[model samples]
Target: MSLTDTRCKGAKSQEKDYKMSDEKGLYMIVKITGAKWWRFDYSFDGKRKTLSLGTYPDISLKIARERRDEYRRMVATGIDPSANRKASKLVESIEVKDSFKLIALEWLNVKKSEWVSSHYSKIEARLQRDIFPWIGDKSIIEIKPIEILNVLKRIQDRGSLETAHRAKSDISQIFRYAIQTDRAQNNPTIHLGGALKTPKEKHMASIVEPAQVGELLRQIESYEGTFIVRCALQLAPLVFVRPGELRQAQWKDINLETAEWRFKASKTHQDHIVPLSKQAVEILKAIQPYSGHGLYVFPGLRGDDRPMSNNAILSAFRRMGIEKEEMSGHGFRAMARTLLAERLRFPDGIIEHQLAHQVRDVHGRAYNRTSFLNDRKIMMQDWANYLDNLRKGEDVLPDGFTPLHSMQY
Candidate 1:
C-alpha cells in the first residue's frame, strides 16, 4: 500500500528500523532514532542497489514515487541513475574550479616571468579594470563568442578602441592558454577579429624643420627648471634615446673617457651602447656634481633614490608653451630620424643602429647590438655638432658635419 500523510505524521518508531512501502521501489524508512528517510531500491545489470531520494518530510511520498519511476526508466534504458548524478556533480566541480578569472590569472602568473614589470602591470591593470568584472566568473569552456564581443563593445563604446582591441588580444591569449591546459574547448575571442573597429594611427608629434628645431633647442637651454632636469633636457635632443632610458641612466653605465653610455634596452632587453657626443659628455659632467653619487642620473627632485617621473620632460615641454601635439619628449627621436636622414644624408642603416631599433638581416636573424658601432660613433659626434650649430642659429650642417661619402651603406 502507498504511505499516507496522516500515517507518516502520526507513526512512531519501533524498537528496530522498519519501513512503510509507498509504491514500486519507493519506501519511507522510520529509524529507531525516529528519523525518516526515503529510499528507492532498483536492479541494474543483475545487481541490486539503493538510491536515496531524500528525507521523508523533505521529499514527500509523491516526490519519492516520481523519482523512483524516473530511475526505473533509466535502468530500463541500460543506464545507472547514481552514476549519471555523480558525473553531473563532477562536471559542476570542474566548471567552478576552471572559471575564466582563475584560468586567466594562472596564465598571467606563468607569463609574468618573461615580461618586464611595466608590461606586466599594464596587462594586469587592463584585465582588472576592463575584463574581470564582465565574464570572469563564467566557465571558460561555455563562454560564447557573442558574450566576449559584448565586453569588447563596452570597451569600444567608452572611446578606448585601441585598449578594447588590446583587451581582445589578451582574452584570446587566455583562451589559448585554457585550451592548452584542457580547461576550454575553443577560443571565443578568435572569432571576434572583425567585430571591433580599428583604431586610427597617429604619429608622435615632433619638429623636423631646421628653423623650428633651432628654436626648440634655444628654449630647452633656457628652461628654468631644476638643474638636473635642465641637463637631461639638454642631452635628450643630442642623444635621442628613449625617454625612459635617458631618465633611468646610471652614472656607472656612462664612461666619459670612452665617451659611451651602455645599458640594456628596455623594449628588447638587449645590451645597447650609446656613443656619447662631445656635447652629451659636457652635459653629463655638469650634472655629475649633483647626482653623480646617486643611482639614477636624473633623480627625482623630491628624492635621489628614485628616477625622475616619466612625465617630467613632457610636463616641462607643456610649461614652455609647447603643446603635446607640437612636440613630446619622444618627439626628439622622430626629429633626429628625419633631419639626420634628410638634411645630414646619413645612411639609414647607421641611423637605425644608433636608434637601437631592431633590424634583421636577409636570413631574418637579428643584427648584433654593436653591428655598426664605429660608424655610429662618428655619426653621434656629427649629430651633436649639428645640434650645437642649430642652437647658435648657424647652418644645420656645419663644416665638420658632412656625411660620410665614400662608405657604402
Candidate 2:
C-alpha cells in the first residue's frame, strides 16, 4: 500500500531507526532522533542498491513519489541512479579539467620559448582581460563559435578592433593547439573569419635616408648616458637584432676572440648567429669589464640579476632629441637592411638571413640551412665600416671598404 502524507508526518521515532514504506522501493526512514529521510531501494544486475531522496515534511509524500518514479524509470532503462550520479560528477570534473582557461594556459607554457617575452606578455594579458572572464571555465570542446564571436564582439565594441582581431587569432591558435594535443575536436576560430574589423597596417617608425641614419649613428656615438646604455646604443645598428634580444644578450653567448654572438632567435627560438664586426667586438670587449660577471650582458638598471630595461635603448633615443616619428628601437634593422640592399649592393638573401627572417635561398632552401656564414661575416664587417664612414660625414661606399675576410680574426 502507498503511504499517506499524514501517516508519514505523524509517524513517531522509536528507540532505533525504522522506515515507513510508500510503494515500489520508495520508503521513508524515521530515525531514533525523530529525523526522517526518503529513500529508494532498487536492484541493478541482481544486486540491490539504495538511493537517498530527502526528509518527511521537507520532501513530503508527493515530491518523494515523483523522485522515486524518476529513479524507477532510470532502473527500467538499466541505469543505476547512484552510479549515474557518480558518473555525472566525474564528467563535471573532467569538463573543468578541459576548460578554456586551463587549456590556454597550458598552450602558453608550451609556447613560452617560441614567442618573444613582450609578445608572450601581451597574449597572456589579452587572454585574462578579454577571453577568460566570459567563457574560461567552459569546456573547450563545448565552446561554440557564437560564444567566441561574442567575446570578440565585446572587444570590438570598445573600439579595440585591432585587439579584437589579435584576440581572435590567439583564441584560434589556442583551439588549434588544443586539437593538436587531443583536448578539442574542432577550432571555432576558423568559422570566425571576417568577424572583426581589420586594423590598418602601421609599420614601426624608422629613418632609412643615409644622411639621417648617419646623424642618428653620430648621436648614439656621443650619447653621454650610463656606459651600459651608450654601448647598447652603439651596438643597436651594428647588430640590428630585435631590441628584446639585444637587451637579453648574455656574455656566455659571445666569443670576443672569434667575434660571434650565438643565441636563440626571439621569435622562432631557433639557433641564430650574429658574426660580430671588428667594431662590434671592440664595444663588447669594453663593456666586458663592467658586465661580464653577470648573466646578462646588459643587466637591468636596478641591481637585480635581470636583463636591461626593454625601454632603455628606446628611451636613450628619445633623450637624444629623436622623436617617435623620426626613429624607433626597431629602426636599426630597417636602417641596416635598407643601406645593405640599396647602398651597399648586398644580395636580398644575405640581408634577409642576417635579419633572422624565414627566407628561401636561391636553391629554394630556408635561411636556417645554408647559413652563408662566410658571406655574412664579410657583410657584417663592411656594414660596420660603412657606418663609420657615415658617422665621420665621409662619402660612404660600402663596396670600397676592405673586406674583413682578408684579415684573420
Candidate 3:
C-alpha cells in the first residue's frame, strides 16, 4: 500500500521494520524506530546491485518513483544505469580533463623522442618561456579562438613578433596532435592565420664584402677573447663548417699529421672530413696544449668535459667592435662561400662541397662523396693565406680581377 503523511502518524509507533513501495524496483524501508529510507535494486551483466536513493521524506515517494522510472528507461535502451551513474560521478570529479596545459605537456612529451637534444631544448624552452603561463590551465575543449589570439597578441606586445608567430604555430600543432589522439576537440589556431598580423619576409644572411672579411679577420686576430674562442674565430672562415659542428669538435676527430678533422656535422648528423690546411692545423696545435686532456677540443673555461660555450666566438666578435649585423660567427661561412667561388675562382661544386652543404643534383641525388676533398684541401690552405695577407694590407686579389657578383658579399 502507498503510504501517505496522514497514514505515517498511525504507523509512527510501530516496533518492527516494514516496506513501502515507491515503484517496482524502488521502495521505502521503514525501520523499527519509525525511520524511513529508500533503496533501489537492478541487474547488470547478470549481477544484482543495490543503490541507496535517499532518506525519509528527503526522497519523497513521488521523487523516488521518478528516479526509478528514469533508471528503467535507461535500462530499456541497453545501457546500464548503475555504471553510467558511477561514470558520471567520476567525470564530475575530474572537471579539468582535456585541459590545454595537460594536452600541451602530453604533446611535448610524445614529440620529445623525435627531436635532437638541441631541438628538444629549443622547443621546451619556447613552451615554458612563452605559452604555459597564459592559457595552459584552461580546458582545451573549452578554449575559444579569441583566447588563443589574445595570448599571441600579448606575446607580440612584448616585442617578439617572430616568437609570437612561432608560438602560435607550435600551439596549433599541439592542438592538432591532441585532436589526433582525442585529447582535444578543436584547433583554436586554425583561424589565427588571418587574424594575426602577417610577418615580414626575412632575407638570407650574407657578408658585406671581401674587404670587410679582411677587416673582420684583422679584428679577430686582435680579439682578446677566450684563447679557445680566438682560435675558433681564426679557424671559422678558413674551414667554414656549421657553427654547431665547430663548437662540438673533439680532439679524437683530428689527425694533426694527416691534416684531417673528421666528425659528424650536427645538421646532417653524418660523418664529414675537413681537410685542414697548415694554418688550420697550427691553430689546432695551439689549442691542443690547453684542451688535449679534455674530450672537447675547445673545452669551456668552467669545465673540462664541456664544449666551449656557443656564444664564445660571437662574443669575441662583439668585443672587437663588430656589430651584430656587420658580422657574426656564422657569417664567416658566407665570407668563405663568396670569396672562394667568386674571387679565387674555385669551382662551384668544390666550394659547396667544402661548405659541408647537402647539395642536390639535377636528378635530386646528393653529391658522390669525396667529390671536392682533394681540391678543397688546397683551397682551404690558399683561402687561409689569402685572408692572412689581406689582413696585413698586402694586395692579394688576382691580377686583372673584376669582382664577380658573389665576390662583393
For each of the candidates, the C-alpha root-mean-square deviation to the true structure, in angstroms, is 15.8, 13.9, 15.9
Whole-structure CA lDDT of model 1? 0.84
Better of 2 and 3 by lDDT: 2
Span of 10 residues, lowest total lDDT, candidate 3: 400-409
Superposed Cα deviation of residue 11, candidate 3 (Å): 58
Can you write out model 3's per-residue Cα lDDT over 92-120, one digit (the tens) per residue? 23456565666666566556656646767
Give per-model TM-scores: 0.71, 0.71, 0.62
What is the overall TM-score of model 1 with all chains considered together?
Answer: 0.71
Better of 1 and 3 by TM-score: 1
lDDT of 3 at 104: 64
How many collisions per candidate? 0, 0, 0
Per residue, candidate 1 scores C-alpha lDDT tens digits across 1-409 of 7778888887789999998887788888899999899988888656688888888788877777788898887666545666545434433234466677776776676577777566799998998889978888787888899998999999999999999999999999988877765567888777877899989998889999888899999999899988878898999998999988998899889999999999988878888899998889989999999899989899987798888888899989988999998998889999999988888888888888878888777788888888879888988888888888888888657666667645775
